[model samples]
Target: MRASLVPGVALLGSYPAKSLPRDLVAGLVLTALLVPQGMAYAELAGLPAITGLYTSILCLLGYAFFGPSRILVLGPDSSLGPMIAATVLPLVAADGDPRRAVALGSALALMTGAMALLAGIGKLGFIADLISKPTMIGYMNGLALTILVGQLPKLFGFSVDASGLFAELIGFAAEVAGGATVPAALAIGLGGLVVILALQRVLPKIPAVLVVVVLSIGAAAVLGLGDRGVDLVGPLPQGFPPLTIPYITLSDVPLLLAGALGITVVSLADTISTATAFAARTGQRVDGNKEMIGIGAANVAAGLFQGFPVSTSGSRTAVAEQAGARTQVTGLVGAGAISLILLLAPGLLRNLPQPTLAAVVIAASLSLADIPGTVRLYRLRRTEFSLSIAAFVGVVWLGVLPGIAVAVALSIGNVFRRAWWPYQTVLGRVPGIPGYHDVRSYPHAERLPGCPIYRFDAPVFFANARTFREQILALAESQPRPAWIIVAAEPITDVDTTAADMLRDLDLDLELNKKGVDIVFAEMKDPVRRKIDQYELTATIDPAHFYPTLDAAITAFRTTAGAEWGPAPAEEAS
Candidate 1:
């Protein structure tokens, strides 16, 4: 039970001796990326740069203690940064007190963490399926564009008072036209971008961001770039993050709840997806509920340490895996390294150029765009592609929080839309084939002389109940009217009350038909048959009409009608 609750204990118990060096090295390498990213994402969340470090430290430590994924690195993420800013910025006083912003941010994180924890405990991990793959692609693409546009002003060494993506883009353009951007900052930012890109192409294994950061800092310090109108991150405070509880009035909690729920959904979705992907590669399985708990713990720790929410970092996790991470010990070492930096050299990044940080963030955002995947989706499924496009537009035009709602709604709506008008077809037997296939797909196939086999691909639920009845009745009206309507019930796994009523009505309607058509269900699952009995459908329709297989139903039909039937299809015997 304890091992189930604290996965780290089990990981440590089986920790290999030879893996220690690799884990340590991976941890140190991860620190190189985490330090810069933590600060960049922190600023993106509208918090002080130092808080990013705090978030990284606590999240890494917390995840190490509770997370199930051995190599997934938890830290401040670019996607959630805008979400945090959106949720907390409005609540800050007009004067924009930094302390109040921190408190609000902490409260948001705490609330999100608590919600996620409750969801995990409730075993509601299936909720992650709310966002389909297409929706995810759209959401990430929109988020990438949003983050890119939001960072443009910083990249140009200017600030804009814009509210959203379009307004921000307009503000950025106007600033450029007005010559508000500083040349030195632009040079540094562009130089940083070029160096990172070139190194990534030439030597993909190199830590390009870290190298660029060091060079940029060195150049800024030696060339006195700060004096030439370049903005710097300034000095960060030394020592560990102070622990504090987020204080908010009851009134504030209600306002923050909506935002917290949004954050929890987005964060958990990303976490579970990343964990599942990495676990597949490593030949391991991840528990979604346990992952929720781990992520919740990380967020809770971050909130208590004057930090905002965090998520699993795919890039960081990749780096750790490549660096030979063997267990959660890698996260522990990474957290320890960051803590030591805070304790010993917190001001080391004081000369880091702000434009360069913006450049780093922009590069990270670039990774979020999935153009190739989106294009593939378009080529394969046009409707899904359109849904993806809608999700992207929703995020870009409506804002991140509202975009989440739109994306989720579109995902769920797409599911119901498919089920509501499910693909159903009449079945026929091919010349020498076994069983039955869709008549539309096998036009030359022959239909039974006085029976029509029908197949509905989805469950009979409230939404599709009427459609099921209509389609069945339409098939019954076709020429060579079926004396016995054999339903291919293999695909119909469920039958709701509404569907049961619809089925009863259909049975009564068939009974009244002058041709004397009868309905029979073939290959019906036991559970569905039991549901019919529960609905008192057995009293209305003959219980003997339920056949275990299509062949059995056909045999029974032959016996009832005293009609000679053709031999079974070749594939049936095989």
Candidate 2:
């Protein structure tokens, strides 16, 4: 049980000594990227820049101890920043107290961690699939837009006292219109963005974030930009925060819980997808439940250490892997390196320009938006495209947490819609085809006269039983109806009590009204046949009316009723 719960423990026991050097090298490479991105994502989350580093350090250490993946990197994520801010900023409100903000942020992480832990323990990792692909794409695109808009003010060298996407947009415009833009800050910000994007485009292996950050800091110190209207990160706290429980007032629990739920869904989906991608490359098996446990531990650790929630970083994981990371030891080494920085060189990033942080976040947001995926959805499926648009609108208009709720609701609604109105068709024998096929697909196919073979695609349940009964009744009342009405029962995987009862009533009604034109089931599964017996449906539907195969049903029908095959009449099209 312990091994299952903490697979990283098992990994440690089998840890090879030679792999240590590779991990050490990879860890150093990852640190160069982690430091700048962490601070940037922290700012994106509306927390101090230092908390990002705090989060980066602890989440790595925590996942190293419990994570199942050999080398998946976990840290503050750009996609999660707006969500964390949406949760924490409201409670902080007009006061904007840093301590209260940190407390709320940490507590949010705790709530998120607890929920994930419970889900992992319950083996409910399949909950991640609750959000469908199109919804996820739309939700992420909205998030990318939100992040881009939210960071614009900081990038332009000013502050916006606005909440939500539209308000922030309006505020940013007003700030720009009011001549509040600092030329030096904007220049540095735009310069950093250019350098980062160019380097990443031309030199994929180079650490663009680290490069931009180091050069920006050097420029800031040499040019005295901080003294000339530009804001600096100043200095982070001297050392790591002691472990302390995150706290918020009782009144805040409900809101925090709502946010945590959304966070948990997004985190699980992101982690699983990222893990699967990397696992495929490394030939590693991904255990979703174990992943949840690892993520839970990571969030719990961050929450206890003055940090906030986090998720897997695909870019960072790729960088680590490309740098020769062989196991979680790479994460531990990175954590240790950051710890040393906090202890010995806390002021190392003091001159890092704040605009460069915005540049980092903006770049990440660009990656999050999936225009090609959205376009593909539009080209392939209109219903799903509509769903994608709805999810996107929900996120942009209703905020991140509410947007996630909308996305989940749309996913479930889409599933129910399909089940409630499944792709039903009438089957007929084609000239050359062996088995019966959909008449809609093979028009002019010969159908047995006076006996229509209907196929209902979905499993019969209480909700769709009425539709089933009505359709069967419609088939019975059709022109020139006679003898047994054949049903292609192969697709009916399940039959509930309501459907069974309805079948019994329908069979009786056919006998009374349609003059012995009873229902004949073909290719019914054995389990469903037993269920029919269990419901005592044989008392109404003839025991002989059920057939093990469609050919058997056809043979029995021909032997009993002498029906001849002929082209479906124009009136039979319905």
What TM-score would every model get versus the actual structure?
Answer: 0.96, 0.97
In model 1, the runs with Cα more than 4 Å from the true position are 510-512, 562-574
Location of the lowest summed lDDT over 10 successive residues in candidate 2: 510-519
lDDT of 1 by residue, 1-574 (tens): 6988888888888888998999999999999999999999999999999999999999998889888888999999999999889888888899989989989988988988898889899999987788999998999999999999999999899999999999999999999999999999999998998898888789877888899999999999999999999999998889986789988877787668988888888889999999999999979998999999999999999999998899988889988988889888899999999999999997899999999999888998998999999999999999999999999999999999899889899999999999999999878777777778886777656667678788999999999999988877776776567688899999999999999999888888944366778889999998988899899998888899999999999888878877554433445323
lDDT of each: 0.89, 0.91
Candidate closest to the true structure, highest lDDT: 2
User: Which runs of model 2 end up more than 4 angstroms from their true locations?
Assistant: 510-512, 570-574
lDDT of 2 by residue, 415-533 (tens): 99888888887789898878899988887788887788899998998888988888887787776775677888999999999999899888888343546677889889999889999
Q: Give the CA lDDT, 0 to 100, for residue 221 in model 1.
A: 93
